[model samples]
Target: MALSRDRMIEFLKRHDYDPNTLQSMETKEIQEAYQEVTKKLLGSYFHLTNDNKSIKTNSILLDMGELTEFKQKLKDCANDVITLIECLQEGYMKFDYSEVNDLLAIALKDMPMHKMQKISHIAYRSFQEILLSQIATALKGLPKEEFKVLEEFYEKRRNDTQFLHQTIDKLKDPATRQQILTMARVKLMVVKDFMPSNLYDVYRDYYNNVPQKLELVAKVRALTGLYSKEYLKEMPFEELETLYQDILKHNEQEEQDRKMFLKYSQAIQESVDNNDDEGFNEICYKAVTHLTQKQLSMLVEYMNGQNPFFLSKFESVVHEYKKKLHIKR
Candidate 1:
């Protein structure tokens, strides 16, 4: 979306530009004025904390009220970005270079040129701290060890534009890119506001290439309990689908086993409480076939400790069953 002339006029009006003055200016002139005024307004929130003679020049600080107001403005900007991202994901909207540039200009308008240049080294890293926080959230679920490495890397070379680009370029493989895109989409859904427009464009490209795969990838991740990028990169889509089905069957079988274990355990306990030797033997005999080896061992231990008679009866039943199996063979 391009910045409309009417939108620029409206913004100028709120900042005390006269309606008549704005109306007389050309669109380009109004845009330039808007940028200038926006910067000044944003910069007004900061005050120099150190004397001009001090060696440290970057001592800008915000007073309490200014900090509060500035935070609210960042929140507003974040909300707008969230909306734009949602629209882009839904295929109802697209972001142009000019619109993205306009958004970036507004976000960093308060910073000095040198600071802005360093921050803008990475297209996504150029936003304010609040927006960077959103990126952090999007990149969550990376293995903690890997995430720590990423954090350390960013902290070390954050100002090194060449290194950042080179690192990003290395992640050009489709599977790795899709993994990142999937994480961004999932995490961003829960985030309230603020993503850099350029980062949003990256997400847009993912959607354009593989619109339907995101949902399937999310489902496969949940089913297999695998969130690592390496896992996704190595597994093909067909394998993911197969693994999803296999996991579902395994889960269902486990659930059924849990229910059967509970049912037989209850029945065995009841028979023991009633002192019904016949019933206890019958329940144990039935349980042996359904329960796992560990479960049967536990039952044997419990029966032996609780009552000698029950233990004797259970052992007799097992012996008889084994004799019958040997005869059949």
Candidate 2:
């Protein structure tokens, strides 16, 4: 029941590790690596609790004695993992198992190993997202004194930015400039709560409008550049303002698209209930047009339990979209 070294190496590399280093490692070292990656992948959703203590999801270390045990656990515990993700995504972070009993039952049905692998990958990704969102929620719920501490740190970050602007002129070495830019990028965490009111408003808009959490760190990282200080000096405020306007326009369009999607989703549901193929096709076509790629992926996964007729319709719609958009799916 030994692990397939090839498969393990593939998994590690997919998560951005250097497979060469792993190749030379002994059994214990490989196990440690597996545990570390597993905790990282699961850390977000498993550790959430309604407590003052900081969340720690890393403690769920895998203890499979051999590959047989490992594969068995992956198969057996798959549904529970999916159920936990579903509940957390729905904002039920601390609910009892009874609440998800039916969902677990449905998820436990037989499936191909490859399909299970896909679900496992999705569950890991979804957990990471849920964890980030939970961390933001925790920050917002902090006590008044802790909240003030965040504000003070944010002020210090602003002062640091000014200092960097002055120092950038003196930093002639490329390496030093790069180091300073990295520090500045790390400091960008301050933006998460820098203007408390604005952050709250942004989160509110995200929840009310989008189906998923906005990846603020990623978005801000794009705004923060390599040699970030120099980039700011080179880019004119007029251009920056235009970029902001474009973001607003994109968000507005997304909202409109979601509205269209909802209308068609409801219409499709009614068509299914009434056994109306023509109505279903008409509504589903409209729905597919409004769906983002991410939404389409989720919809395909969700159709597993539905009737084959409906599932085929959705698959056809997704396939056409992928061809048109040149998506790799």
Candidate 3:
């Protein structure tokens, strides 16, 4: 958090950071060192959002002085990635979360940590570059006004890459992953009205096809894998939807199902109390795997489509019974 020149100097000295010697190095070399410091203190898997939301796919920032130049830079970057994602999507679903994460990690090399990539799971690199490329492409498709509005945030955050790096390192557990999704949905709110029912189409086309959202999917998958052991390891949408639909049916006796549900609930509580969302997700995923298809399907549907209601009620239940469960530290 401390960005003071003196502090930076002291930090450098403590770690043998030679400044006069650094001056002799190429700008790229110095930049890399500065970035390394940010990465060490911050992290590699987060984004800086201006709205102060925890983990959302919002826009990149731009300083007042550099607004115009930053805007142009963004236009260029977006063009590059959108074209790339389009090519990538031609053969596979553009939703390959790991590949997207890889893109973002690469684009964020010089971003500072005033705010950082606040992800819960490991984010692959290259996600941001792909985003940058997408925006540029989208800019060509929309009216100038729409393009400006759509890209305003991207410009702001992209410019503040350094801060985003730092912001990412400070997040706590579930909050970390939830916030990124929150940010993305916020971005969607800007254009959700214009989006068609086939949201995936809109997502593939005009949307900034960055894996920002995929980070959450990946988190969910990781959590699911932890519990189920065999589930969600490499699941795509069709397979996931099928598996989730299967969770909705409950054919077993109420007592049997209830006991199984309780075990899963307790596991969730354990993870939350410990601030371990990944752990909670695994338990929940595994529990559903054992459920009759109908029961599993219902739960999965709620999770995928009605998350707010589910998460809110789940949080309430946890708080109400924390004492009874002896779950709090």
> TM-score per candidate, in order?
0.36, 0.24, 0.17
Residue 136 miss distance in model 2 (angstroms): 39
lDDT of 3 by residue, 1-329 (tens): 21444444544555578768764666565545654764543232233333435344455553545434433343345435454334333212222344333443454444443322433021222444444455445334444333444455565565343334334343334465454444444344323433435444434322322354344345455434433423442344555555544443322355575665556556656676687866765665565446777555545454535344446644544454455457655
lDDT accuracy of residue 71 in candidate 1: 35
Candidate whose lDDT is highest:
1
lDDT of each: 0.53, 0.47, 0.45
lDDT of 2 at 296: 54
Pairs of colliding residues, candidate 1: none
lDDT tens string, model 1, 144-263?
433443444355554443333333443445565455544433333312122344433423333322434455666667766646634653455566567778888987877776677678
lDDT of 1 at 175: 62
Stronger candidate by lDDT (2 vs 3): 2
Candidate 2, residue 11: lDDT: 62
Using lDDT as the yardstick, the better of models 1 and 3 is 1
Worst 10 contiguous positions by lDDT, candidate 3: 115-124
User: Which regions of candidate 1 are displaced past 4 Å?
Assistant: 1-212, 224-230, 290-313, 323-329
Error of 2 at 88 (Å): 53
The TM-score, computed over Cα atoms with residue i paired to residue i, of candidate 1 is 0.36
**Per lDDT, what order, best first?**
1, 2, 3
